[model samples]
Every structure is written in structure tokens, then in C-alpha cells.
Target chain A: MSILAVGTVAFDSIETPFGTAPRVLGGSASYLTLAARYFCPDVRLVGVVGRDFPDDYVQRFRDSGIDLRGLETDESGDTFHWKGRYHYDLNERDTLDTQLNVLVDFEPTLPEDYRSSQIVCLGNLDPAVQRHVLDQVDDPEYVLCDTMNYWIEHTPDSLRETLQRVDCLVINDSEARELANEPNLVQAADIIRDMGPETLIIKKGEHGALLFNGDTVFSAPAYPLEAIEDPTGAGDTFAGGLAGHLAQVGRYGADDLRRGIIYGSAMASFVVERFGPERLYHLNRELIVERARAFRELAAIPKLAPLQAA
Target chain B: MSILAVGTVAFDSIETPFGTAPRVLGGSASYLTLAARYFCPDVRLVGVVGRDFPDDYVQRFRDSGIDLRGLETDESGDTFHWKGRYHYDLNERDTLDTQLNVLVDFEPTLPEDYRSSQIVCLGNLDPAVQRHVLDQVDDPEYVLCDTMNYWIEHTPDSLRETLQRVDCLVINDSEARELANEPNLVQAADIIRDMGPETLIIKKGEHGALLFNGDTVFSAPAYPLEAIEDPTGAGDTFAGGLAGHLAQVGRYGADDLRRGIIYGSAMASFVVERFGPERLYHLNRELIVERARAFRELAAIPKLAPLQAA
Candidate 1:
């Protein structure tokens, strides 16, 4: 099975209480490609970069089995660049700069060969762009979409329209609540599910993530860590691991969704452990499996005696 | 096994997005007694009340097999009363009124029978009063305590002094962070464990709860609910179920602690489903067991791969 992910592939500068890393090879695609490489080796990435983007970074993805036929490099402008710094909690951060260079005019065009990928991950991007990717995919079994509050607040109609076409919707807790106009998360998720999508995942940074489907809800807590070097691409890393692992399995049920959350959580733990995408870039299958087991044990406790009604 | 709980018995008026309830039975004792009834038929409660308190309300506890002999009534004054309103999310609330009648002069005195109980719960109260309860217990194997930022800020010395005597500490996430002066919760729990308690449960309200012991950490997310009528007494209910079940088992290992959290989470789910203690009042063994099973399902999800060291 092949996984196709389309999102920003650019540069980032990050600062944490530990220190600052200026101009790192970072972006949604970079982090996602690295994190997913351990689970699914063959990942096809589609996004736009610029002449300023290093060839070494592109080569790294190629080495990790990330197909870049759909990647566009424009010599006219720089790559999309983001600069952010972590707050004391590491969960909250301040964005110092955002330069939409090649991304300013990016209109993702999927390669002909990528049209048959089994899994599609539409990372945070314009709703129109998300729709365009979906249009190009032919009978993909799973389509997961990630969006921000900016789209919800600015282009709600287009966002809602795009939401109807996806199997899964990934969003932050606040964004979910804001979009639903309901403060209660459960109700907010219900609203999102009703709009479309069989599954909804509300990320809560260090607090954890919640999955909602129909009347069923599954929650996985974030692996508590002592220090977070950078949180720049943690969410994208989580999305990539989830989509990639699910593609590897080639099936997803209630149980599969649960397992995907654990894999995503374990992947996220490494993403925050270091600046940029360094830690995830070197993650091996053995390490992910080990962390997943710990998460299962941490999440699993025996049920003794009588249970509350089923 | 019998459970001994020391806390205030007060009335509360609550308003939520769901609706409003006027002057409902509330406070730590009210919720604790109802939840503990599931595990043990005979639990002793120590607190103060006043002339305004209804006889039927007091009788309710007595009928539930609670030993209310330690409840001292002051006919000249009124029962403790508080009024608050919850936001739509039920995460935040604004206190509208607080009339600490008999509670203002509360001095917990354990009944003769209560002194022999093996389980002790020290609910939110003055640091001095919490310490007094500890002094009264003969030899409690599992003594759990819950406190708030109010006491931590006002009586740092007394709070620190009381911390030395308990086996487990239950506190809100913010309170734990504030007490330890650590921005990260995992680190905060570590700092707290050194203060005395062998176990620490940091309550994150709707986000669920976390248990930390030196090198071990277990996290549980709350069961997402669409309708939350009232959140009053949810924490006390959680504590009651946890302590009651643990006392029944007569164990305090890591697994036992994890199970206790599940029990607590189940009880809390019920507490928020109705106004005040009405839902908990009529709960049966089967109903409790049913909810417990639901907690397991709500929290249970499969994770891909096994955990291995990096």
C-alpha cells in the first residue's frame, strides 16, 4: 500500500527553553515524511518548494523512500518559512514570522502515477487545495484532512464543503470547538461527524488526543515528557505516522483506529523530544513498536468484578 | 471494609448551559457517600451541618449505610451554601456566592467507629483541619488527600506539613503545577512525589486524570459526554469510588491504583449526567458495574507495535 501526503515542505526556525535552532529543514511534509518512513517505506509527497530550499533536504526524503515526482521547485522565490518559539509549557508557542514564498502561489498538482495511492493525507492547507488533491485521487480508501482555525474562521463554507469529502478530520481541540460553536468537546465532535467524516481526532497537545465516531469515543493521552526541544511539526508528525501505519495495514476498523492513535502518540513523543525533525528522522521500526507497547500497557488496566452496564 | 471520609457537607446552587438547579445537595460528603456505597455498605462520614439542613437530606445518607454520627449540627446557624455557574464546556465555572455557615467553624472529630476504618479520604478543607483528621486516624494504610490552590496559597507551611502524612495526594493539574512551580506536569508530579505521597493523581477535569509514582506514569482521558447537567461534586465522587474500591480489594499496587482511576472516572461520569447528587442517589450495583464497563471501553483502544527503548 502507498500513502500520498500533500502539505507544506519548507524551512523553519524554532526556539525553546533548551536553546534555538535557526533555519532547520522543517515543514509539515518534512516531519510527516520522516515519521512515516519507519512504518511505510513507500510514501509519495506532493508540495511546492523554492530554489532556496536545499537539495540535501530533498535527497534525505528520497533516501527514506519518499517519492518527490510531484514536488515543485520554483527558482523565482524562497520556500515557505516559519519561525516560532515555545512558551514555558512547550504546548503553547508564539509565531514570530511566516513567509509564504513558493506557497503563496502553490496550486498542488498531483503526479499521474500518484493518483492510485491507497491512502491520502491532506495536511493543513487551503480548503480549495485540499479539494483539488481529493479530486485527483481515484478511489482512495482513506482520505484524512487536517485544517486550522484560520480556514474555519475565514473560509468556513469552503472548509465545510471540503470536510464532507474526507473519511477523517484532524484538528486541534480549540479549533474543533470554535468550528462547532459549542464549548463542549463531545458535542463539537458530534457536530463535525455529522457534517462528514467517519472519524474525528481532536488534538490537545500535551494533554492528549480524543477520537470520536458515531457514539463511540477513544482517547489517548500524550506521553508526558520532561523537556520539549521544539513543537514545530509535532502535529504533522502525528498525522503522518497515523496515515502511514494505517496504509501499511491496508484496513481500519475501530480497533485499527485505536492502534493508529497510539502509533501517532508515540511518534509525536519523539517529534517534541528534539528541535525540528531530527529525532523522528532517525526513528526505527523497533523503537516505534516498543513505544506503542508501553502506551498500550500504560493505557490498559484490568477490569475486575462487575462492570457498569455495557 | 469501611471507608472514613472527612469533608464539608454543604448545599450548592448550580447553573450550566444544560440548565439550572437550585439549592441542591452537594459538597464532598454528599458525593463521596453515594459513590462509596457501591463498594461498601458501611462508610463513616465526618462533617458539620446546621439547622437549615433538612432532616430528609441527612436521612438520605443514613439510609445509604453511612454512619452520620460524626455530623454535628448547629441549630443557631445555617448549613454551608455555595452558588456557581458552569460554562458550556463545563471546564470553567464562576462562583456566585459562598456562605460558609457551620463550615466556617468546622473542626472534624472522627467517631469512635470511624477511627478503626482502614481507608481515609481528606477532602478539600483548611490545611489545619486536614492535619487534624490525620492526627485522629489510628493507623490508616491508605490515606488519600485532596486540596485546592486556596489552601496552598494561604497556608503553605501547613499544607507542606500535612503532605508528609498521606499515602496518596489528589489535586487539580493547575494546583499541582502551582505547588511544584513546574510548568510541565510530568516534572511537577516528580517534585510532588518527593514531598511525601507514594502516589499522585493529577485531575484534569474533562481531560481525564494522570497517576504518577516516581518512575511510573499512567494517564486516563475522561469519557466524552454530550450532555453535562451538573459538574458539582464530580471530583469527590471520583475519589469516593477510587478509595472505596481500593479498600475493598485491600491492596495498593500500581495496577490497583490504575484500576482505582478507572473506577473514579466511571463514578465521575455518572455524577455529571444529572443535577447534583440525584443521579448517584438511586444507583444500583448493576448500574455501577455497567458504567465501569463503559469506562473500560471508552478508555480501551489498540495501539500498533510494542514499546521498545530508543
Candidate 2:
């Protein structure tokens, strides 16, 4: 049950009310692969990094057990670098700069060994690039794709084309609304399902997340945090956790999808406790198990005595 | 166990994106009593209504199996009327008008039998009035009080005095922050707990609710609806449902509190389906049980297999 994460492996300069993280190791593929490697060992990453991409970061990925055969390095450009400032609430952010140097003209060609990955996680990128990665796949049993409002708005047709091939789509509340052109999330999920992926995960940051699969909808509550240091890679980490769980289980039943959402929610909760994705790298199996248990306790409803009126 | 609800019982003119419900039956006591009667048979209401109040609405409360012995009629003034307009999203609303006529100088003289009620639900009202009603209660085993930002800002001392006597305090997200002066809801709950009530429920309308009692927190998911006709009395309905559940169980253990939260959340879900408390009035026990089951399913996380790395 190998997971192939295809997207940018770049840098982020994040500024939050708490402090600043300068040029931290980031990008969707970076966080997704790191998170996916916990439950899933055979994680292959396909992305273009610039020549300026640190050797230490490459080593970090290798040390973390992520396959780098598909991690291409551009000879003449810097890595994709994004600079964003989070507001006081951290719910909204303002992108100050975006340097898509290497990613601008990037084209990924999955390695021969990576072509047969069971699960392909298409991270936020050009819709054409996502489909290009999918095109190289020999046989993908499950395809989980992530996209932002930028792609949904700028290249909707291409995005829809890519979405049609994916088994699941992971997007935030606002992105789902914008993409579906519907404010009501349930109806939005229904509309989106008609266009593409049967499964849709609407990530509602601190509120929680909702999984719409077939005729069922499963909700996972956000772990109540006392403070959020940074929220840079929470969404990617969530996707990673979910894909990893699914890959490990090697099935996508109703129960499996629900548990996967919980695991994803737990991972996303841990990532936001610190800046960037530092907290995720330090996590182990026991900690993850306990976090998942904590989530169960948080949303657990016990048996109740029958009402007197009843 | 008898439950007494004390608050404004009046009319509301609500304008949502869908349509308007002009001068419909509303107010905290109106919705609270209607919702609470579903769980606890001996539900008592203590509120003042104007002479202009329709007798049919009064009979409607009686027909719903609510005790109206403490419902006082004031001859000189009109009933409290609130006019509000909900935005397109139904999350934010603008208060168009507030006519605090009968509620301005309302003083309740609770009946002898109602004073001995085991559970007391103090809905959103002037802190002085909430405390006044509590003062007349003979021996309340469990006291659950709700408040708004206006009272927190306008009458801090009185609210704190009322809080000290109440066993549980239920308020929405913004009011909790305003009362505790903390932005983070978990921290806000802690600060508010120290101020008064040991148990606190922070209702996040669309997201869900958090129950903070003792050393535990129980999170409940909001029921995902295709449409929300109005959100006028959702919080009060939530409180009523919770108090009613607790009263029916006749105990307040950790498990009982958790289940109470689920029941309360289910009740709140139905109230918003239509304007004011109209939906609650037509609800039967079977529908309520099903809705609670739906909540359990909505937030249910299945028993996942151990991680592959483990």
C-alpha cells in the first residue's frame, strides 16, 4: 500500500501573531509525505525542487523514510517560495509574495518504481500537473486530490478534469463553497459529487471537518487547542494522515473513511501546535494512538436513560 | 424531577434569506419550555407576558405539557418583541428592533410548587432578573444559566453573582470570549469556570458545542441541515434540551453530562429548521431519538486498526 504524493517541495516564510518562521521547509508534498510516512512506510514523493533546495532538507526526507526517486531538482531556478501573514485570528491570511520559480515550468515524470503506487495523493498545484502525474500512474487504486481556491477559480475546467479522475477531493469550507458555487456545505457536497469525486472532505479549520461519501456524511471535531502557534501545513498534514490511514487499511469502507477523517483531524491538530510541520516529525505511534483516543473521548456520546416523557 | 425555565416569553419578527416569520412565538422561555417539555414531563415556565399576548399561544404551551402557573400577565405594556434580519449565510444577523415593553419592569413571583423544582434553567435575561428568579427557587439541585454579551458588558458584577450560584453556564462563542476576556474558547471556558459555574457549554452554532465540566470536555457536532429557516432561539433551545436531559436522568455524572449534551444538541438542531420554536412544537419523541442518533452517527469515528508502523 504505497502512497505517492505529487506536488511542490518548497519553502515558506510564515508570519503569525505569535512570531515568524523564516523560509521553513514547507510545501504540500513536504508535509504530506512526512505525515503519510507515519502509518505508511512506502511513501514516494514526486515534485520539482529548485537547485537552492537545501541538501539538509533532502536528507531529512530520506531520514524520515520518504522515497526521493521521484523528487526532481531543477538546475536553473530557486524552489517555490511563498510568504504569507496570518491575521490575529489565524482563520484568514494575506499572501504577501509568491515565487513559483521551479514550479512555474515544472513537469513531473514518476519514476518507474513509483508508477504502480496504490494510492496517489495529488497536492495543490496546477490542475494540468496533477493530471500529468495521474497520467504516469500505472494503476492507482485510490486517488485523493487536494486543490485550493486559486485552481478552482483560475483553471476550473482543468481542475474539474483532474477531479474526475480522483477518488476523493479534500478542500476547505470556503474553497468548497467557491468551487461548487453553493453556500450550504451539504448541498455543495452533493453538487460537487455530481461533477467529480464521490468522496469530499470539507476542512473547517478549528471547527472540524466533514466527510461526504456516497449517502453518508461523517464529521470529525477539531481538537480544542489553547493556543495556535502557526497553521501553515495543517491541511496537507490532514490529507497525509487520511491517505496514510487509508493506505494502511487498504480499503475504503464507510467505517474506514470515518476513522480516517478522525486520524487526519488528529494529525492536523498536532501540526498547528507548533510552527510549520515541526510537531509532526516528532510524533510516534503511541502519541498518535493517544491523540486519536483523545478525539474519541472528545466527541464520544454515552448511553443515556430514557426520557421521563418517553 | 420538575424543571423550571425563567426568561422572556414573547414575539419575534425574523427575516432570513428564505422568508420572514412576522411576530411569531419566540423568547427564551418560549423556546426553552417548548424544547424542555420533550424530555421532562413536569416542565414549568416562569415569565411575564403582556395583555396583548394571544391566549392561543398560552394554550399552546399548556397543550405541549408545560406548566404555566407562573406565567404572569401584565396589563399595561406590550410583550417583548425582537426584529432581526439574518444574512445570506445565516451565521450573522442584524438586530432591526428590540421592544422591551413587558420585560422592562418584569418581576416574577414563582408559584409555590415551581419554586421547589429540582432543575432551574435561567435563560438570557438581565443578570438581576436571572439572580432574582434563582433567589426564589426553594432547592435547585442543578442550576443551568444562559447569558448574552449585553449582560456581560453592562452588568458584570450581577452576572458573576448569578454565575456563582449556578451549577452550569451555557453561552455562545462570542459571549464566552467577552465574559472571560479570552479569545481561545478552551481558555475562555477555564476563565469563566473560575468565575462561577463549574460546568460551561460554549455553543458554536454551525460548528458544534463544547461541554467543559470538571476535568473533562465533551464536544458535540451540529446536525448538518440542508436549510436553516431561522436561528432565533437555537441557544435557548439547546439549554432547554440539556437541562431537560439532566432532569430526566436525575444525576449529573460525567457520562450523564456527555449524553445530556448530545440530547441538547439534537433538540437545538430541530429548532432552527423553521422559524422560532415552531419545529420543536411539532416534534415527537421518536423524531428526537432519531435526531440524537443522527448526531452520534455524524460525529462517530469507527474503531480503526492499529497503525502499520506500530
Chain A vs. true chain A, TM-score per model, equals: 0.96, 0.98
Supply the DockQ value of model 1. 0.50
Would candidate 2 be rated incorrect, acceptable, medium or high by CAPRI criteria?
medium
Candidate 2 residue-wise lDDT, B173-253, digit = tens: 889989988777889899999987989989999998999988888888988898888988988998888888888889988
C-alpha lDDT of residue A244 in model 2: 90
Q: In model 2, what lDDT does residue B307 have?
A: 65
Q: What is the DockQ of each candidate?
A: 0.50, 0.64
With a 3 Å backbone cut-off (N, CA, C), the pairs that clash in candidate 2 are none
lDDT tens string, model 2, A1-310?
9999998887999999999999999999999999989988899999988889889989989989999999999989999999999997788899999999989998887789888899999999999999999999998999999999889889999998998998999999999999989888988999998888989999999899999997888889999999999999999999999999999889987888888888888899899999988897789988898898899999888765545553
| Chain B TM-score for all candidates, comma-separated | 0.96, 0.98
TM-score of model 1 vs. true structure: 0.95
Candidate 2 fnat reads 0.63
Where is model 2 more than 4 Å wrong at Cα?
A: none
